[model samples]
Target: MDTDLTPLRDRIDAIDRQLLELLNQRARHAQDIGQHKHRAGQPVFRPEREREVIAKVLQANAGPLLSDGVTAIWREIMSACRALEARQQVAFLGPEGTYSEQAARQFFGSSCSFAACTDLDEVFRSQLSGSSAFAVVAIENSTEGAVARTLDLLLAHPVQICGEISLAIHHNLLRRHDGLDGVAAVLAHPQALAQCRQWLDKHLPGVERRAVSSNAEGARLAAHDASLAAIAGEQAASQYALQVAAPRIQDEAQNRTRFIVLGGQPTQPSGHDRTSLILAVPNRAGAVFGMLKPLAAHGVSMSRFESRPARSGAWEYFFYVDIEGHQDDARVARALDALRQSCAFFKNLGSYPIGRE
Candidate 1:
């Protein structure tokens, strides 16, 4: 139990140093690869190559740490190397710190360049206006469902959905002190607060819930006053040096948010992909069902179906659908062709590989 462990500890430390040197060498090779890709006018991210590398690393890993640990470290390395070749620029809704920013960094890596916009519309505009090559915008949350603002933005913007990123949301009740009894006001982004409404109501019943721009902003505001509490992500609490009164305060145990990547052009089909489209149909009996029938007949599975109020029309709505299949596939093309004739207005929103995390 109390035996000497100095030799093993020293060996482990030596191995870690060697691992660091190997990582540095790998990064240098990655820089050369980036230069080659850039000279050839290729995109920095190659999903296929990444998948291959992850698989290889996972298979080769054999130690105290498992595949997950190795994959996690290598993923960050790949992202950093990719950024060095050409700074991968991503736009997101934020004021420097928000869930969108976190999701963007997780998806694009920390080394990539970032643009924080004031609103969801600005995120789309950044991509459309060529200010940023890609945009990351939240689409839905497990408890709150789809973000209405994001859906509306997609309807108005011509940018295409190129990929999807999912982030696990861990909300914490942060304050200047340890307890919630002395807290007078609770602050959080409107959406963040809404997601944890049930918990807040049960715990801090009479407290005033103030809406702020983001979770990080709420944490910053709470840090300034001992009587104020904030509901935010873990990163916010850490960044603002606030005390976490309650950890994992979200209503659902599996709280997660899905973000969509927006860009000017569609991605090439990577075998398994999802395509999104907006359709406006005549207000008639079985119109919605009729529109969906083509997809059903074509054996295409519908991943998401949402309806939003249509502009320039009286009491009309547009249906946004995410379906399984690439646009170039014969089955998808046939379904789109049939659906186009039944719908008044139809727009393809592009297709991309599905993200798993």
Candidate 2:
């Protein structure tokens, strides 16, 4: 029996073409809207509007792709349209192919222009000096805890936390050779090695761990030497043409690093937001509790609280807090006012949309 379905297949192909054409037409309309927004001095990224559009599309799309898939496709389309209107330049700590670079790409899609800085300080300077529109710097790691350098930079710099991205840390053991038995030395950034210490100790027991400036550098070194292995991300393995000897070799499977997007102005609150601030308190008992009491009174949750040694003064510390509301919120405003009365010095580090894992 000849089940001739050629006509139906042709119809399906024609429909696919029509769908693509309709998408292109929509994109053109988006471009026109972008021009109008630019003329009116309006921001290209209207998250609330985007959410509404996505919700409507998902509700209407009842066919081949799921709602989540439809949302994903539309988000990329929206991102492309926004890029055409305003080319956002992002800066991040890297020599390229670092986890920070990955986080930046995750936050701002791959189409966005990026400038990779050598250090966290450079990332801050790039945004503050307007060399880049925004910067991404790692604030905290799951295993290693908070990055003190980032804290210091936040205290010293005038930039605001406009957004945040959470990146999962998956350390891979890469080498030019296929097998791990031939690997004699391991190369990686100090932090990467520290995060995967237990795995390294058990798997490659006596191998020499050489600390480098960046994970990309480590991968490059491993690429150059057949016997050397590098502890880096899966992306680095392909970038440097190294084979993964051990995948996901980090000590913890749930390990994640949070990167903050720093810019000149505060970000518009996205409903789900977090505010960071620095406070210096006198060397006295209950000083910390006094500062936090207002938050409790105002029903604001504290997500993170850490203290760094104050650079200028002796025996005094600067407290860094991440609260669960925007600075513009009345509760947050009252908490800040009360906190000021208790602390010697206080600075709001700008609130932004919270990054979800």
Candidate 3:
């Protein structure tokens, strides 16, 4: 026989009612703040402020709930309150169920609107054209070093990095049918195909692999054709009404993707921040070292350094660097000034809060 849970259920119900009352109270306070902001001509959403709020809430968290759960709860609460002021419109590459879409939701929460674009170019265009407030685009992955198209777009577009999201990736084999039997062609993005290469080689040796624009697109195709299967996340499976043939089939167990939030305005320093920049140093023998000397002198820490071909028919390259502090910081500003003097081409890609994994 099971012990009675009526009293426990009643207690939880009462607590939930209290939570509802408190949330509404918070929302009303947010609306009052929004009124003041409107009078001051200030923007409704502030990324730096949101970061501080999350950090403070996490610091005060007492236990019971896991850190992730607490973060999610506070994020939703803030999101709801923010919606009372203004709901953000975010853009991402997808029909639906793409990792980029998930990353956008992770950053902005479900209270915001989403504009799904066919390609990365469209994703960037949506925000640049004022159709969306921000664009969440994949920058790099653990298995795949960088998304080359996104990096190139970053160089091409007049956009600024406002925030970031680091999402754990788990690829599942999705199909209309339950088993892998009769699955003719496997569909997925090229990177997803590469990440699960070893698994595919062992499980479905002779199956044809077809590359698509995104995993969600592959999932959409797999939904209609029982002969085709998709390598994507569980979200794709649910979105397309497909069954999971195999779950977490990626070669690496700890695969993750880093997505950057692109916006028109630069973000204010959030104390804990990361500044990104694109540079092309003069083609002198010690030019690269000369450019880096200021960062060392100013005591600025560099987290990432990546080089991409400049495509000018010459052998020149563009270097992308991520530093520890915001560009507004005194040390970082000084380093950036010296860097500008040392480079042939320099582009400050805006500073934003460091994404938590």
TM-scores, each model vs. reference: 0.88, 0.88, 0.97
lDDT of 2: 0.83
Candidate 3: segments with Cα more than 4 A from true spot = 1-3
| Order of the predicted models by lDDT, top scorer first | 3, 1, 2
Q: What TM-score does structure 1 among the candidates reach?
A: 0.88
Global lDDT of each model? 0.84, 0.83, 0.92
Give the lDDT of residue 239 in candidate 1: 81
Locate the minimum summed-lDDT window of 10 residues in model 2: 43-52
RMSD to native, candidate 1:
2.8
Put down candidate 3 lDDT per residue, 1-357, tens digits, no spaces: 124887888899999999999989989999999999889988777888998998888899899888899888888888888888888799999989999999988888889999999999999899999899889999998997889999899899789999998999999999998998998999999999999999999999999999999999999999999999999998888999999999999999999999999984677889999999999986779988988899999999999999999998888899999999999999999999999988999999899999888
Poorest 10 consecutive residues by lDDT, candidate 1: 43-52
TM-score of candidate 3 to 2 decimals: 0.97
lDDT of 1 by residue, 1-357 (tens): 324787888888999999889988988999988888779977777754665677778888877787767777777888877776778689988766678889888766788889988778888889999899889999888888888888888888777887888888999999887977888989988888998999999999988999987777788888899889988877777788888899999988899999998873556677778899999888888989998999999989999998888875688998889999888889998999999898888998888877767
Candidate 1 regions with alpha-carbon error over 4 angstroms:
1-36, 47-52, 59-64
- Candidate with more favorable, higher TM-score: 2 or 3: 3
Give the alpha carbon lDDT tens digit for every residue of 1-357 in model 2: 235888888889999999889878887898999999779977666644565566678889878997657766876777777787787888987777889888887766666789988777888888888888889888889899888889999998777787787888999999887778877789887888999999989989998999887788889888888989998898888888888888999999999999998874556666778999999877888888887899999999999999999866577899999999988889988998999888898999888877646
